[model samples]
Target: MIDSQLSRAEDPELAVQVQRLHQLKVCTRWLGVIISWLVVIPFVTWQLQEEIALMRDHFTLAAVRYALIFNPISAIAISWCLGLTTAVLLWQSGNILFGFSSRYRHQLEKQVRRIRRRGKSHVFWRWVIGSKNQ
Candidate 1:
């Protein structure tokens, strides 16, 4: 599935993401894991105290966007917006980072292919074996 170039600095394929590299299914699975851990967990554990804490934290901003002056429904709504915003931010930045790394992988792939084409196979094999040392 890994059709992109990977850098020597950090080939996820060479490490944690090795087996799952370049697979849409892997992304989906990972996203599902994150959502379960982050969104569902806290939501399920939610209580009235936590809701009040949320209202207290955003008390200043409420004056501007809301006028009802704090209720259970408003507290829940504010907390949800905060959680959703954090998730969306993470997703967007993660996407950008992956896009950049994919490009880097493509560049590395081209470089490797170029060397393989121009350099003799025996030479490459010798280099891999560390010359006389190995």
Candidate 2:
């Protein structure tokens, strides 16, 4: 299905824009996922409870203590994820700041503006489908 979308996108100009936007969106999602894991993983590890039937019972939870204590795990996890996020954000920040840097972003914004005015599905279709050749 994705191959089809990429192939379809290759055929037109709009498709290229969609593909790039898709790429950007994917990067964004990955950043979120990696960050979440960074927090959750070491968290379970620090509390020394990676697996269990139940994470919490009536009145005790290691997760709570791990989070509250002066453990480096939390700091490390947050730092790791944040460090990566920061790197990515720093890398992309220039593009976001310049907006003018990538003609693609410009084109994307143009498409958005046009779509708002014309209200046509074809606009979206083309933006996404144009990427196959790309």
Candidate 3:
């Protein structure tokens, strides 16, 4: 589908713009993941401080094992969820900062329609995309 779109785009500048938009999307996603992980790590550590202190004081194999297993697992799960919010914010900000071309706008509207079809049952759908009336 994208290949067809690219083939149909005769203007070199339009192609370049589309490519840059794609790159921006990819970069924002990765940046969101990094930001989420950075935020979550310190937060999770703070929340688990008591457990960490107990492990430090006792120095048991079980405590060490639990710390190794649980902290990262919980942090990752939390950060993975948070990353979506950050990514959406970042992407929206990018769109605002760099206004979309007509071609991009059409593409974005199509994507928005697809997202709207997912309905309010999706956690982020209503907040991010809004209702059909809006």
Candidate 4:
């Protein structure tokens, strides 16, 4: 079914439709990510407030200080990790959802390999001298 859809995209009208569908899917995926964060942020904040009140009532001053300070620091560190992970996952999902063909991937890999083979000096000199193709 997917292969037939891909082949049908060779037609201009079908290609346009395929592109629109891909865009809609990408948009919906991001909307899902946004909606999830919206629901999670408030729930997490509520839980944190309840936990903090418990900490203040029960723990020692030193313990409370540690919790107060470290809690946010740790939350920030964890949030950063989660955000990075989400970003990478979302990007990959977008690529997959938008039909980044394996042929393009292989071509990109070949280009990268060729550049790596040229070495740093060759690339640098090419840029410095404004040369196109060695």
Candidate 5:
């Protein structure tokens, strides 16, 4: 997408808008990742502590085994869920606040339509670009 946008860099106005949108997207994505990790680390730690405490008396290989196996999986799932949710929310809020070019809006609406076609079962269906219906 950036590549396609850059190709139109000859148009100064478009170039600037694309640059601004790109920067916003990048910042929001990283912020989402950081927020996800911040939440996941402590939550996962507390979960592990609680599980270990509960199994302290009858501590067996199975408890440790399951923790080792499931913790990472759960952590990854939770992180992706939180990260994507945060990113989408932040992106939409930014769009509402700053607005975007018609080209960008069209692209976003196209993406939202594709996601919507995937049905409500799609992970991002709920947050699929807010400007879509507009």
Candidate 6:
């Protein structure tokens, strides 16, 4: 679909802008999937409970006490750690991987604004809803 659009574009600058927008959209989508997995994997796993049981069985009182004290703190710590990791990775990818400097970001924003005013609702809603259906 984007290929057709790019092929049909009369302006070279517009073609490049569209290509960049498509690349950024793809990056946003994959980043969302990666971050969701990072945020969800730890809490969703059964391994933690098994490990807690192992500690209780092996180390008895000391492990149980430490585990009880540490569980909540660890959950909070893990959440913050994952969040910061996500932010850092996103920044790194934007800067290094995607070459998305602030200037290109502003250009993308302006292009999106232009699209919005042109009655193209898909541009605004695509990232929010993760849908291509218009």
Off by over 4 Å in 2: 1-70, 99-134
RMSD of each: 13.2, 12.5, 10.1, 14.4, 11.0, 10.9
Q: What is the TM-score of each candidate against the true structure?
A: 0.25, 0.34, 0.42, 0.41, 0.40, 0.34
Clashing pairs in 1: 5-105, 5-106, 6-105, 13-18
Error of 4 at 4 (Å): 7.2
Clashing pairs in 6: none
Cα lDDT of model 6 by residue, 49-114, tens digit: 765677756967767556546576555545665675677568657767766555655566466547
Stretch of 10 with least lDDT, candidate 2:
50-59
> In candidate 4, how many clashes are counted?
0
* lDDT against the true structure, each candidate: 0.47, 0.55, 0.63, 0.55, 0.62, 0.58
- Model 5 error, position 87 (Å): 12
Q: Which residue ranges in model 5 land beyond 4 Å of their true spot?
A: 1-10, 50-65, 68-134
Candidate no. 4 TM-score: 0.41
Put down candidate 2 lDDT per residue, 10-80, tens digits, no spaces.
64544555555556555776768686776677665655453232344523566555443655665566566
Q: How good is model 2 by TM-score?
A: 0.34
Q: Write the per-residue lDDT of candidate 5 for residues 1-134, one digit (tens) a residue.
A: 57545545544443444444455556767777777778776776676886678578778888876776777866575657676777677877876798766677556545544655776665654444333354
Query: For model 3, how does the per-residue alpha-carbon lDDT over 68-120 read when each residue is reduced to its tens digit?
Result: 57777665666565767776777667767986556675674454445557766
lDDT, residue 64, candidate 2: 51
Model 1, backbone clash pairs (residues 3+ apart or across chains), number? 4
Clashing pairs in 5: none
Q: What does candidate 4's lDDT look like per residue over 35-133, in tens digits? A: 666766675556467556777688777655565465685466447556855885877676878856756434433444454466555543333222333
Give the range where candidate 5 is weakest over 10 consecutive residues by summed lDDT: 125-134
The per-prediction tally of clashing pairs is: 4, 18, 0, 0, 0, 0
Residues 15-115 of candidate 1 have per-residue lDDT tens digits of: 32322233433365567656645754454345344544666777655543343243445456556656765775676577567653655445444544453
Regions more than 4 Å wrong, model 1: 2-70, 100-134
Give Cα distance to truth, residue 124, candidate 2, Å: 15
